[model samples]
Target: MKLKTALLASVLTSAAFAAQAQEVNVMSWGGSYAKSQVEAYHKPFTAEFGIKVNSIDADNPATPIKAQVEAGNVSVDVADVEFSDAVRLCDEGLLEPIDQSMLPAAPDGTPAADDFIEGALQDCAVANIVWSTVVSYNSKNVSGTPTTIADFFDTAKFPGKRGLRKSAKATLEMALMGDGVPAGEVYDMLDTDEGVDRAFAVLDRIKGDIVWWEAGAQPPQLLADGEVVMSTAYNGRIFNAAVAENQPLVVMWDGQILDFDLFVIPKGAPNLENAKKFIAFSTGTKPLADQASWISYGPARKSSGALVGLYSDGKTQMAPHMPTAAANLENALVNNFEFWVDKDAELNERFNAWLAN
Candidate 1:
């Protein structure tokens, strides 16, 4: 009887530890982007820490984090989100404040805060990559090559349905850029109601032929299906479709809107310690560099830039494909997270009304 009781107790203790060793759930935008994280972060993390990572997808990771936190049913340990959304959520007390001191410094001994690009670090989030939303078109579908942001709206020159994200953030910036608003002045113009009207006026020119897309994957699929001759897409998606899948898609860097994607721990994550460990490891110089080989997005850390090289295909260089590449930066506009954080509700309301009309 004593032996049997001891055996049962041991069995129960082992089972509890096994259950506690299960995977940490991470939520992110799906498609090739998620695959990049899986290869660069998840697999290595599991091997190193013995804790598995279960990646989940959403249309926008930020949206679900908010819902889960407010309902007090938080499940996601970490999320990859845009700069503006990260800022907005952190402000609303939905995110766990990250301690920058815990971040690993650069190889050269520069602190993480200084090694990261300006605006890459936030109070509650740490940026991982600097990506862009740029104009892309199927070369096979277009009559002539379109070279500029203005060409995206010039239906008379490159006529076909346009694919645009169903959001005000990138879409409004692109609309204003198409209307000949210089990159430097985009935010200033957007600050005024009349400027917002001007942006809508630009969209009105192409609204009749617009096919709205809500997912990052949809833009590439839309172009592939001959539904849209030209679309605005995250640079990494177009790079994957063009390089990996052999699609005849061309990306126009002109008027690209550059922004950061950050890692944030939701306020009440079940595995808070492991989540922080994952963020630190994933955003470190080596892993960030490894991710660049899988996708075209530039790493947020200055130290990681030197380590980036050819794509996973082993032929194409990743630098020129990056949003921060000198050629790509000519007319690029860095997304103003502060502006978005302040005006998101107001602008989105107007945008929805405009879409309804």
Candidate 2:
């Protein structure tokens, strides 16, 4: 279940070097998941296209991506952009707008431009997978279990220390839900200033009991090590961590925040064509399912959805973030990245200021 970067690099070098090293640089959020995608899918792709891919880690960083693009030092030919960042990149003229004819098209003749799942399309990028920041509790520590964000925040209802992510985008949406907003209304609420403040107010109630985690990796690790009894976590990270020990953790789809990872080309990318090819190839169902098997991502490919139907033991074979698994949740969140992208600047500032307080 643990992703080994060294081993993956060795395998990829052998496989890809034997094929293509014409070399295109990709700035993705490098880590186990990104590595696996490279070693598994990208390596084979290079073999076919004779194009080498250099993956650089451009994880959710402190500085804005627009700054990097503006500086003309755009190091990434292909980037694994967050939808929110992609929007900002597009607005700033820091993204290479994709041409549908140049990319893969769906069976119905719609180009890859429209192949993305509903609520996932944007002006600058394509969502590659879906995930959630949801209630994950160590079964070993708690009496029963928390079923939703409300339960996680309900200290009197379920007494224990809880974990919340440090980001404002998803956190604010979760807060809005806790404040009694319906899952579907989250984006609509964020469209108004009053709703944003109202969501923050909801967070203030449980702020004392909540410990903050900054990345997808932290919350699951904390859960596995018994650091926090219960907290919110990326569905895949927690599920992947559980592969070894079968940790007593669960993701309640109820009011769960829908999140995703996207792929984009930075402004002034040299290998724009190659980047498009890589994206189209990687986004196909089988490669996506390859990620789903070990990585626990909710595949964005329509074919990945069809492919999952072939697996019988959905619980045993799929992680909670999988479309099959998430289908069972009572409540689910739909993240409107377009909204976050537009508001990330102001929202992130206020979020940081609030966290500091």
Candidate 3:
């Protein structure tokens, strides 16, 4: 009787441990982006490993990650963050370091280090997608086609309210580009006081016409509802609205700001090992390519490019729609994370002051 009781107690304890080990919490930017990750990464991961994934959303995952880590109550096992935030958070020691060797090799047996695109792997982050912030307009509302970046600033030509993100980062870059600063020269120009003034001066032209959006989901809704005719938006949101929901939206590739979204483990994640496993499985070549089918964002791995084909709708080809496509690259600007990492606080202070005035 004593031996049977001990055996029952041990079985119950082991079952509890197994149940606890089979779940992970992932935080990400909400809206269509989150949906894409759920479809491509989460569903497959859960099926393959028999682990439960809890999907959490925020306007920006970075904010909650910082808050949680600093408060010493980290709940998120993994988070999808922008390149600058990843670098900044890693530098501040708020994230766990990810070794490159843990990532899976390509299908052809090429190592992960060689398969990933340049700058995709970092000390504490592994990139999943290369997304872009582009200018998009509701076709039914706009007067004529606004092809160039400068057209976005010219109210006289477009003649409707513009939706601009309520942040200093992309807003300033687009303003400089609208004022005719070339893509390659944008960062160098923004590095100066005079250049900063120039960008703000251009923004002042359309200040009254601007409708500010802080979340990725807002831009598409703003355009669809005619709240704003033209908006600077994440390309994937625009694509989803246009293709999936059958909205009359058009993306202007010119002046698009390309950047990467990476997955990182918080400093003290409750399921650290499971988080690492999720990252490895999700970032593999097939999974990366699978994400592109759900959204127009390019895969971070070079090996995944060839595998990216039609969209989920079964007809739309994805390559030409990608931000990295040759045609789209004509006047595109790759985001300078280093510049933003150093200048984000100072510029945002000035931007807030300007907003008040």
Candidate 4:
């Protein structure tokens, strides 16, 4: 009787341990961005909760979320996606609506909704970082420094192959800015047919000199290989290239398109409860601020800003490198999520037709 009782107790303890060892699969853009999350979120979350997190990479995490939800075979538990994708996916009923109340308040007790930046928290998502797509050039390859957006289109002046993301979103906005449209009016201008033509007209000047890139990692590599002298890249990637790799790359912040990357859970996530816990914990003040140490992207919470200091190198100051930094914001365009949510498909179709032409 004593032996049987001991055996039963051991089996129950084993079952409880197995149950407590839940894991979440998180998908994000690979490279420095992924590394930042691993240090700031994944490792800490596991340490705190004993929940294992599986890190996965995709060129764009949003693409797979839609497929997984629609097919009813969701594998991803939590995903890092862009503002527009998060909004669109939520609208299409593909994502689980996040309860903002579950998010931890600021250290001083400010509510999560009040602590996060305006537009950072959405119905189905919570933002993590404010990143920008900006132009970067190899200082060693360029003849003169580029101080403005127009310089990106000036092949005759700068004279080298240019690298651009093969997407219409940032490409159109950057073109308009290069054509001298004010950052505030970029989306307003693109809303008109003539304005779009003007953007394409700007693109026409450098069409022959453009080398297109599709992945986040490609732009930095393109600059390093001298495949293109100037490229529009995620600010963090260029920072890593210059600060981490000791490359001659210089980021031109004049025409940057700033946007947010948010955390969201899919509607049919296998581990919904754990997924929510991960989002709430990872997006808390300290973790969000901790992420800044690994990448140049700005944290979404205003409170996190004060905590941001040096880069992982411990010497490179993160402030000047952030897209939200005062000096850098002078000419930066905030990505119009509503405009993109409505027009992304239409613009991309037109963009693809133009690309093939």
TM-score of each: 0.97, 0.83, 0.98, 0.95
**Tens-digit lDDT string for candidate 1 (147-254):** 999999999999899999999998999999998999999999999989999999999999999999999999999999999999999999999999999999999999
Which segments of candidate 2 are over 4 A away from where they belong?
1-21, 61-65, 106-115, 119-121, 309-315, 319-326
Superposed Cα RMSD, model 2: 8.3
lDDT of 3 by residue, 85-132 (tens): 999999999999999999999999999999998999999999999999
Global local distance difference test of model 1: 0.95
> What TM-score should be assigned to candidate 1?
0.97
Which number leads on lDDT?
3
Tens digits of per-residue lDDT, candidate 4, 55-89, equal 99999999998999999999999999999999999
Ranking by lDDT: 3, 1, 4, 2
As for lDDT, the candidate ahead, 1 or 4, is: 1
The residue ranges of model 1 lying beyond 4 angstroms of the native Cα positions read: 2-7, 10-18
The 10 consecutive residues of candidate 1 with the worst lDDT sum are 16-25
* Candidate No. with top TM-score: 3
Write out the backbone clash pairs for model 2.
139-248, 253-331, 254-331, 255-331
Give, for candidate 3, the lowest lDDT window spanning 10 residues.
Answer: 28-37
Of the two candidates 2 and 3, the one with more favorable TM-score, higher being better, is: 3
Colliding residue pairs in candidate 1 = none
